[model samples]
Target: MSRLLLLSPLLLFLGLAYLLPLSGVMLQSVTTPEPGLQNYSAALGDPLVWSVIWRTLRVCLCVTVLAVVLAYPLTLLWLKGNTATRVLVELAIMIPFWLSVLSRAFGWLSLLSNRGLINSWLQSLGIIAEPLTMVRNEFGVVIGMMHFLIPFAVFPLASAMRSVDDRVILAARGMGASRMRIFWQIFVPMTKSGIVGAALLVFVFSLGFYIVPTLLGGGRSVMIAELIYLRIFQIPNWGLAAALSALLMVSIGAFLVALIKRAGVSTT
Candidate 1:
């Protein structure tokens, strides 16, 4: 009775927020269009929808990989650095969290456009005769997402690296293990959970991401999240939209399960 009372607020919040809304979406996916599996079948059968879903997956994976690559080294450096340097690096990572997603996307827009900072710099250096197209492409989307996700990846990675026993690393070194070998053989395996956690975080969020992908992709690449909006608002197909949302949920859930299983997370 006491435990139930204590948990009431959280349970209420979940009921009012997630479970309710998700139930509505899933219910509509099946029932709104005459109580059948037609929406699911139609959505699954649509080539365009499949393409968008596949693109979303690829973009999410790309961002996850790039973010992990960018973060792990910085995290290691942060773990090893002196107080001042660590403070600076940590502050750099934390700064992005203070900014809105839209602001970051638009900021990248300015930087990645033809007349943006990078292109102008290259042009000034006479590296190219004309500004290279960077924005409005899959490349821009990945770059923009990596900016947002690197900190997410870094936080977990830093925690994992910090948790690693220094004595173990020292023992490996004492055993004549090269720095690279010890890092690869010992450090990497120990950090697998953190890597998977970050990958799950970035991958799941990126797949359903709207603002950054919408701004950077410029319709050249259509992520499933954006397609859901287009279907709901532009095309006004609630059933189809709901079906796509269901698909997105399933994909994220399946991938999350795979990640958890791979990381050997003991739920019980």
Candidate 2:
């Protein structure tokens, strides 16, 4: 009872800060637009809306995959390295966290745009007569998202990896197991929870991302969040915006539930 009472403030804060606002948004999404399912029906019927949603999902999946793949090696290096080296690598991963999203997007813009660094270097090297179309497309969005999400993916995996029993791993190695066998059978299995957690974090973060997609995607790469922004601010269609927002929430909720189930399975 005392512990429950102690946790009440934190629970109340979560309810006020997170749940209440989300519930309000959900209500607005369904309640507006003539108080019917018209908005949802429209969202369902609109191919353009579906396309944007698909693009968002595709980009998020790509980002999650890339982050996990990249973070795994980096996390292993961190685990195996000396304290100083590990700290340096961790700091390198976190440098971007301190930087603003707009700044990071602009950095990519400079690197990927025509007449930018990559193009100038390519031109100097005589690789092509003209610059490549890297920015203002799905490629740029994926790169930016991967950059933003890798650190998040790494931290969770590193934390989990740190908790793994080194003696158990040593015992496996003493039994003549190869390094690959040991990693796959022991280390990877133990860190499965962290991998799922990292993937879930990356996916959820990607789902709500707006700035990176907005800046790098140009007009061609429209995401659901960006679409909702346009509906509300650009088109002044709050009802439709609210409906889209509701759909976004539903999608995120469904993904999270699925992730939780997967994580539970891995832990068991």
Candidate 3:
């Protein structure tokens, strides 16, 4: 009772800050522009909306895969390395968290733009007659998102990896299992929860990204969040924006539900 009372303030704050706003948005989705489901119907039928959604999913998938592949090795290093190695690896992973998303996006923009560092070096080296187009496209968005999301993936994966039993792994080694075999047959199975958690974390977060995609994509690669922005602020279509917000919320909720179901199954 005492603990519950102590938590009431936090509950009240959350209700005010999040639940109320979210409820208002959901309500507006159905109630705006003289009511009915016309906004959602239009959004569903719009080819541009579908394109944005597909692009968002594709980018999210790419970022999640890249983050997982990169984070797995980094997580292993953080967990198993010597003191100095662990410190260096941890610093490398943690430094990104200190930077703002806008700064990171512009940093990538400088390196990846046609006249930026990478292209300049390539041109000076006579690698190509012209600079390669990197930013202002899906490739640039993926790079920026991966940089921001890798740390999120890493920490969740690290938490899951920390829970893995070393003794079971040692038993596998004692049975004369090769490193590859042990990794494939023993280590990976034990750490699947981490992999799933990290993948879902990266994917869901990637869906909500606005700044990186907006700045790096350079209008050519608009995503769902940016589309919502255009609808409300640029186009001044409040009803459609509310509907899109509702859709985004639904998509995120679906992913979370899937994650919860998978977690339940894994535990069983």
TM-score of each: 0.90, 0.86, 0.91
| Per-residue lDDT over 72-114 for candidate 3, one digit per residue giving the tens place of the 0 to 100 score | 9999999999999999998999899899999999999999999
TM-score between candidate 1 and the true structure: 0.90
Q: Which ten residues in a row have the lowest lDDT in candidate 1?
A: 259-268
The whole-model lDDT of each prediction reads 0.88, 0.88, 0.92
Clashing pairs in 2: none
Residue range 200-226, candidate 2, lDDT tens digits: 988988999999999999877988889
TM-score of 3: 0.91
Highest-scoring model, lDDT: 3
Give candidate 1 regions above 4 Å deviation. Answer: 1-14, 258-268
Candidate 3 Cα errors over 4 Å, as ranges:
1-17, 261-268
Q: Candidate 2: where is the Cα deviation over 4 Å?
A: 1-27, 258-268
